[model samples]
Target: MDKQLSPVELRHQIRSGEFSDQTSGLCPGYTQANLVILPKADAYDFLLFAQRNPKPCPILEVTDLGSKNLHTFASDVDIASDFPKYRVFKNGELVAEPTDVNDIWRDDLVSFLIGCSFSFEASLITAGIEVRHITAGTNVPMYNTNIPTKAAGKFHGNYVVSMRPIPQNQVVKAVTITERLPQVHGTPIQIDHPETIGITDINHPDYGDAVEIKDGEVPVFWACGVTPQAAIMASKPEFVITHAPGHMLVTDVKDVDLSDIL
Candidate 1:
């Protein structure tokens, strides 16, 4: 329950079953990650898909097949136990939502650490921009969009986007600030018009809870990390594992390091 714990300490808490809460605001200055675990047979295609669609699927680190450690991102980290929660998919269906995946770990599984928007949200808050979802105490609204991704091998799906309502005058400033962190899903993909991106109702979303857009505010969209989960479901892989939405893996890398990568 210590919000100021280092990424290593947070991971240790998760490993010891002491903390299993969503990792949204925890470890504030560190980078939080989306995780994807796939069998080696499908890894090459997934990696290529990520490479082709960097906006939604930025690669942070990829562990060797059968290895539980992601040495580049955190020292002595165990992929199976570091995250607060995990989702197990079988042939595209979610079979389990478990706190730990140790029992399900496989020798041929490859772990991919993906960049998450949580890293960028901190920057948005620092710039005096009001993140409506956070202010309203609700998960960010996410919608399936008409935006198409560049397919690689068996992976292909429409883009998934996260929404935030910004005032008309501040939209440009928001875009400029977020654009600097391209590793964490950059600027607004669509502004003011939800229908243009295939979102039928601004009050309803495909994932996460809806938040109110005030009288002078316009709903803005950003490419989301969940886009890959949609792609994996569409591709119907025989088996896959991903971190539960909003429940991310914290890494030792600072958000400033990600800015440096841009």
Candidate 2:
């Protein structure tokens, strides 16, 4: 469980069923992705959905229909098992949470690697800004907000966001640093205003653990990869697959070079 393990080595462990846990704190300097798999019938519309709602669905790579390999993320990535956990949705309801989807994967299945907030976390730390969830050893708190994303075809729903409590003074610095990584959810979408986004209770997050918001700290929200799942669920697509909350696909790309995909 070395946090510095290379992506290939870490992915091997995941494939072997040796590791099936949150990928957030691992491979700190590498880029991690949100997994989304859909059949070819739904792929085009979904891709259009992502393109319209780029912040929450910032796409890193989209695999061809029926293709099992994607070179954009890494040379040795297996969509079926590189992720520690996968959630299967049928008609929008999550039906199964599997460690690997090889048993059900089909040639018509298309996969997408969406940018995740974890990619910019290290930069925040280096900029003297604390990432609250990482400090608390828990997954970042996420919420489904009242904010709506632009609709594309059958894909239409509200945006989901991840929240991090920042000190009042360091908020601007945090924004400036994270804004540099546009491919991985750049900048705070809502700064210091939880109620503005319709989060009734910050302590009870819709996903992940809640961390304390210390004195003088304010809640900041960032566009999240979960936004797509929200749309998928609302649209009630016949079939869909995505990474379980908190778990993610580790990529061979380095964090410093994230802008290369931008």
Candidate 3:
């Protein structure tokens, strides 16, 4: 697998079935997104839910019903085959994890691309912050917290968060750098206290790998794009689809393009 492929070329590989792997660290400077597809009947409620909670569900683009083309991301984008992997949900239970959504495509489905923290990982590495999971070649640790999202229609659930251990000295710098990328679930929602947020054992996470915390480092938590998946599971939506955890869509937009400070 070539790590330096451009977003266009990488997406092409995904579209052609030549590549099907987690997209983290693949397109280093490009933006990445989480995927969500739902029928038109549930579209308005989901859209309102996203708007009610922007930090965890920041909207990057929303395609029209019956269309998979995303105007702002790429002209040639194909939602069904663009991501390396997709998860299918029926009544909020995962029934299939496929490489593409070709067989399950529906005309009334609307696709949404939500901001992902992978867009900010490059910046974190550039600032000398150690993204332990990346260095360890593992998925970032994610957990479900007790924090409740504001109710929107029938969608209401706890927030999901991704964790990274930052060196004590670099914690402030991590916050300063990430806060600017608000469009991508910015900053540490919790810097040191895990128990305060209902996460008891940091070692066992609800999703992804558990990375080591070095001697002087403290765990930092950030709102995650997977919050929607949690909501889906909690509310038992009739039908929904999402990108598998860590398997994101590499967008044509550069990470810096989404940041005002850059």
The lDDT per prediction is 0.89, 0.87, 0.88
Off by over 4 Å in 3: 260-262
Model 3 clashing residue pairs (backbone): none
Look at candidate 2 and tell me the lDDT of residue 164.
92
- Tens-place lDDT per residue, model 2, 6-75, is 9999999999999999886788788888888999998989999988888899989999878768877787
- Cα error, candidate 3, residue 121 (Å): 1.4
Task: Give the candidate order by descending lDDT.
Answer: 1, 3, 2
Residue 94's lDDT in candidate 1: 95
Using lDDT as the measure, name the better of candidate 1 and candidate 2: 1
Candidate 3, residues 1-262, lDDT tens digits: the string is 8898989899899999999998877877888889989898888989999999888999898998889788887767899999999999999788999998978899999998899887678889888887899899888899999989987888889899999999999999999999889889887789989999999999999999999998999999999988976776788888899998778999888888875422
Cα-based TM-score, every candidate: 0.96, 0.94, 0.94
Residue 80 local lDDT, model 3: 95
- Model 2 spans with C-alpha error above 4 angstroms: none
Model 3 TM-score is: 0.94
Better of 1 and 3 by TM-score: 1
Candidate 1: stretches off by over 4 Å: none
